[model samples]
Target: MEHEDPLVTAEWLKENITAPDVRVVDATWFPPFLNMEKTGRQAWSEGHIPGSVYFDIDAIKAGGTDLPHMLPDPVMFSSRVRKLGIGDGNRIIVYDQFKFFASARVWWMLRVMGQKDVKVLDGGLQAWIDAGGELEDLPPVPVERHFTARVRSDLVKDANQVLAASEAGSHTIIDSRSPERFSGDAPEPREGLPSGHIPGSICQPSGELRTPDDRLKSADELRTLFADPMAPTISTCGSGVSAAVTALALARLGNWDVAVYDGSWTEWASDSSRPIAKGAA
Candidate 1:
């Protein structure tokens, strides 16, 4: 895919929010830490972008399996997206509260569903507020949207492919985990999961991609972060969550070739049979 740098800054969005066919999606999702137990949804109910639809990753997902928020079946996804009032010709903008968090997941889902014109809001919500932007008390009632699914298998990888890539060094597998978790010094946030990282993967915690106001860093800053030229360069994190944050940062720098390991370290660590490395890659 010929990817373009299509970010709309908080200022940019504020100036042209009423623009036609420009749809904003609140793709906010968080781990248990932020009390994913309650607040994410409540926070949105309290305030959000007017005319913006909540693109709940947990909902409208293929979630029957134990695998965390995996992509839904194409037809199922198509229907769920249609319910969101999103259509083929619309320009989609995704954002979230946890810095870059789940917005990338929505972006990736759109790509898999074959929507290529989507972009991420640089800096997300914290940036919006710091910039003194407006907020909406009631969610927008968007017109029904029609969407098509473009399942890009090449853009997604499983544990086995990642393992092979690890040994071959065919691509850069950037782990978007904290230095502590990456170093195996601190256990995974998810209970019972093993410590450490996949062999050959580099530690590039997702936090580095953000600014003081919680917005994505500059293009030059991001480009220098993932300076790998290998094929199939990708990212991963616990249960494939924060990994999407890494993908979004890469996409902001126009690095769309990167993919998220859907089965991430959670899956990799689940099977003790898989090889593991400690300290550094």
Candidate 2:
């Protein structure tokens, strides 16, 4: 499905936040390696956009997997989001404390689950504050809304599919990890996981797509960064979080065909059988 701009400005959200048909979601998250003292829920409890519910990426994930924040089943997704008062016909707006970080992951998750009108809050919480938006510690009591998941398989890829793309050279694999990590110079935050990237994948650090002010770069700039706008691309990151940033950037350039490798590096490196390549792509 063709989606309108996958982003909404803080001013736009501030104006429509109270609308019955709108739901604002806070997707704040911190990598486990950071050793953050406060969890995303704790951060949300302190202050958040008024009426916004916290969408914990870590909690709302596929069960029975050692993987970090893997996509949950449709039934789980539908049930969890329903309690957030997110359902059909409601426009969902997601934001994160760190600008465009975890919010894009949530946005991508919603999109892949077939939510027609999900968008990230451009510049995230800071943008909201800058736009004279107020924050409230009190959480809203959300009325349940039924959410139906018409899973969009085209938007997601598994390890086998990514490996085939890497071998056949039919698709472009875009790794969103940092240059050091992509090149094997830096150790992975996850212990015992070797550094380096998938064979033939190109490194496009997600941070580079963001401007100095924490907003995404213009579409023209993003087009240049991506090089080939029409390539069938699969975005991958340390786990699967930042890859959504790449997907969002491409979607901003009117390229919605980009698929995210859901398991990403963590999944790829976990198994010794997968081929790993070092140095530049």
Candidate 3:
């Protein structure tokens, strides 16, 4: 089944928030190293779009993995989102507190779990406020519903798969980390891990795909940004979060032959045996 366009404007969301089948989600999250005083849960508790539910990426992730916010198994994902009252028929709109940050991760997660009606709020919560949308402090009451999750394995990649992709000479491994980090010139936010990208990868910082207001660019702009249309890609970032930004942009450009490296640089750099590339890739 085809999915909706990956984004909705704040004005559009304002008009549609009340629909019976629409599920508005505040899927905000912050990396601890960023040192933000308020967490996504804190921000949502203070005020969020009316009737919106919070999706805690950190909490909903796979439990056994050492990596941060790794994708959960289908059973766990279906159970958790079902508890959030999101079911098969819902049209889900996910927005993060920051500009296009964690919301796309949630969007990708839902898509890979076989939910096609999901989209990210174009400019996120800030854009909502900028558009003069109303917010409320009270959390919505939860209603139980059954969500069916059928995992789409093609949308995700592991560290070994990423390595294979790089070595096999077909897939384009895109690193979404900042140039400095990707080049080994800056220290990683997580201590004890080396700075650098996987060998043979290309650097495309996630922020470059967005505008000054933090909304993503148009399809034409994205096509120019990607340049090469033929390469199937594996998106990677410091800890798998920002890679979703690239994945989302690719999807907006109608390039679905893409997968996100779930472990990302955090997993690759941690391993001493993995080949690391420095200086502009």
Candidate 4:
């Protein structure tokens, strides 16, 4: 099966801004701790890509689940994207205002839901602006389209799989949180959760995979970053958001056997029954 490139440059997007088969999505989001004044919707209202729609990462989460922004059911995901005028065959380009933060989550989510023609905007919204791309404050009138979702189970993992991986030592569990957070020295952004990482997991902060300008590193650098080219990886982060960055980086290197722990540290730390490790893997 053919797959999308997984990333697109600002120039490519700018040139294809008006293509009928192309759709731009603003997936900007901030963590609770950032306390940003503007919501993702509000920011899109103020200014966004000319024909882009805002993909609310938090709003489209799985209902009836307490976990934040967990992947929704296939039916719900299809419904949400259809409303955004995203059809099965459209080429989706998702970008976020927060550097490389939340955009990859949407990219991962879309791909896992069987939409292979989606890509994250490299360097995100800032890259577009830096390249002299224009932003439109007016929201486009969305034309309803039919969307189909077929969940790719291999791309996602739950606590049980992670625990098994930790115990079996057959898979690599990579934590993408900061060193301070991974080591339990810094407090978790979400209150009440204990700081630290899962046992037998290695640390690879998502920020380290991106350049200072937020663009991803070259394939050679990424191959070096991930020395174990053959290990099955399960990525985790504060609440599964940044973990997607690690997953995206791995995907860029043509590694498709990776999965993200949906509940991540938030879920693992909440349960005292789960094994936790502090100060290095």
Candidate 5:
């Protein structure tokens, strides 16, 4: 199957929102530190693209793990998304309220689960509004669709694999956290977790991958940002969220082989046995 572009514009989404095979997903999420009054679902309930469903990353995740939003087992994932009316032969477009934030995470999740034809909405909900698209408070009642989860193990990495990559240097470990957090200069948002990144990992803040308007930067700019774009890479961030942004950026550069370290800093730093490196990479 020919791979589609990893991103879609609001204009395109507006035109295709009502298509039978198109599924629009609102994947908006905010950090607990933000203490936002409205949850992603609340915001979506207030107003969202017509015919769109909400995917709560926090709710649908691996069980028996304290780690936040770890990828659920294939059976669980298939069941969850199927209930959301996301299934085979559907073109899924994911978007977040904070422009380019959490949508990429959902996109990465779907891709990891072997769902093809999935894309992130460029610039997110704001872009939709900017494009003169309308929002609706009434949610659609969708019939369950048959979603088969084909797990792509290569697209997700665990703490052990990340450790191997860090120690053996087999893969380029890209830290998507802010420089301050990556360098151990700032405390982590999660209580009791020390700052500092994995040894030999390079810092590339996910925020830098986007334009002022929240759209991803041009391919040339991304190529410059990732000096060695073709290298085998693993994206990591706070609790595996922003890591997807890094993965999305790499995908934009036509590099789809990048894997996301699901545990990321949260799981890595929690274990005292793991080595931590401070300062710029």
Candidate 6:
């Protein structure tokens, strides 16, 4: 399938599997509700695409941040990418087995750092497997190449910034949590956080971007997904994880100003002083 942007389908990835300067990264992650019994590293060891590297989303994170998996420093992120066999010139194809989760996070992270040619593998690993693609018993030993990270600060925002925006009504906050969670009808997965979303935020469950078979929906469908009173949005979710998916979806649509609320609702609701809206965003 051809896209106007830089997405590669399973069939496209399979055909390009052996191409030079092409790198595939497995950005798989599970929510607290769905543990893989082991981490993605162990999963990669058991079996992964041949010549692929594992991009541990949680491990490569911003240190010294109150939130989980905040963006890592530019220098640190660049070093990590190089160690993973990625470079500025290479085309990146990222995917995750758990439908659409951390895969988009990787895609967004790379693109934010000004890597113009990165793309997500449509449908992730399941689609690859269904397409008769082969797998390997281990990840390839990568010869480290230089992957530079130019910090695109505009693409990210901290909890404080989001709080300020919520008060001033300067930007639309798009919460990627389930409707029940956003509405306070469901308890948050992370303890100590109050139920509900930020006042004035909009609810667009990140899972809406996925098709029935776990493939990413077409851009046309995505355009419809973001159509709401909420415009010019920032994305937030349970502890800033899946919220990145919302940012990724927006980025794919060329919303360059989008940001991921680093602390997300976990930090927001945990602080009783922060204002919240109990029902409907």
Residue-by-residue lDDT tens digits, candidate 6, 109-145? 8867778778888788888899999888865899899
Model 1, 1-281: lDDT tens per residue? 23666567888888877889888888877776545655666667778877778877777666667767777778988887777778888888888877667887788878867888887788788778877888887977778877767788777788888988988898899998888888899988778898899988899998888777777778778778777533467789887767877877776666676888987887898899998888965
TM-scores for every candidate against the unseen true structure: 0.92, 0.98, 0.97, 0.96, 0.98, 0.92
| Model 4 Cα lDDT, one tens digit per residue, 161-186 | 89999999978999999999999999
Q: Which structure is stronger by lDDT: 4 or 6?
A: 4
lDDT of each: 0.79, 0.91, 0.89, 0.88, 0.91, 0.80
State the lDDT of candidate 2 residue by residue for 35-60, as single tens digits: 99998888988999999999999999
Candidate 4 regions exceeding 4 Å error are 1-4
Off by over 4 Å in 5: none
* Residue range 1-281, candidate 5, lDDT tens digits: 21556999999998888788999999999887889998988998999988899999999999998999899999999999999999999989999898557899999999989987899999899999999999999988988999988889999999999999889999999999999999999999999999999999999999899999999888888888988887999999999999999988888877888999999999999999999999998
Candidate 1 vs candidate 5, TM-score winner: 5
By how many angstroms RMSD does model 3 differ from the true structure?
A: 1.2
Q: Which window of ten consecutive residues has the lowest lDDT sum in model 6?
A: 1-10
In model 3, how large is the Cα lDDT of residue 84? Answer: 91
Estimate, for each residue in 28-76, the C-alpha lDDT of model 3 and write its tens digit. Answer: 8988997999999999999999989999999999998799999999999
* lDDT, model 5, position 229: 84
When 1 and 4 are scored with lDDT, the better candidate is: 4
TM-score of 4: 0.96
Question: Model 5 clash pairs?
Answer: none
Clashing pairs in 2: none
Determine which window of 10 residues in candidate 5 has minimal summed lDDT.
1-10
lDDT of 1: 0.79
User: How many clashes in each candidate?
Assistant: 8, 0, 0, 0, 0, 0
